[model samples]
Target: MTVAGEWIEKITGPFEDKKRYREYKARTKLLPESHRTAVEALDRYLMYFGSIGKSDVLLRMVDDLIDLFERAAADGTPVRDVVGEDPVEFAEEFLANYADGMWINKERDRLRRAVERAAGEESEKEGESPR
Candidate 1:
């Protein structure tokens, strides 16, 4: 598999597994109130794609959406401010940018490298060989 394919598979594995999905759903209850809505949104979005088995593109989109929310939250930005009045429109605009050839390939490469680097760091921490 290509690096992007490997990264997507790794990230989406839990969402694809029934047992993991149940565990993830249960764990959401423990998140802070501020983060709960974002988690729920991600869950619903994942489910929408899961039902259709359209995971390849879904994984990329979900990854981007999660990063966007995480950065916004970490920066203490209100969801309303980040997404504006119509979140659907905001998301559509965000996705449209990726539909452009230049942005899509650049973003994909960046995500792939980030995932690979994170995996390597994790393996190093555990004293295991990197993949």
Candidate 2:
């Protein structure tokens, strides 16, 4: 999911739209207390990719998902704990839980598919070029 400001705006009605709410939350350093651990984990995970300061979308979505995971974890409802029926099911479940907002899942899936396609193409190219 893309975590559109619209959903946040709707979820937090009368406060402000999603954009304004993000600013408000950022200035106040306010996230559900439960999410502290997960959010911290997320921060560390993000560091591996580079500082969020370098990418606006990454900064926002990463921040938001961390907050969500933290909240869910605190509630004793961590997303990662959800069991899947099988490998494919588990992968889908994991991705869904990891993704935040509306188009986030779609984007993640697209990226995953692209990577897989690239790998397949590379194998085919190698196979055709070699004996």
Residue lDDT tens for model 1, 11-75: 76743564544545555555456665865764575344233243444455555556566666778
For model 2, how does the per-residue alpha-carbon lDDT over 1-131 read when each residue is reduced to its tens digit? 34686686556553424465466346334544534544544455544433222233444555555555545655777444533235345434434443443354566689987785666764565565322
Give the Cα lDDT of each candidate.
0.59, 0.49
How far is 70's C-alpha from truth in model 2 (Å)? 5.8
TM-score of each: 0.41, 0.30
Cα RMSD, each candidate: 15.3, 11.6
- Tell me the spans in candidate 1 whose CA falls farther than 4 Å from its real position: 1-32, 42-53, 95-131
Badly placed stretches (over 4 Å) of model 2 are 1-34, 50-54, 70-76, 79-131
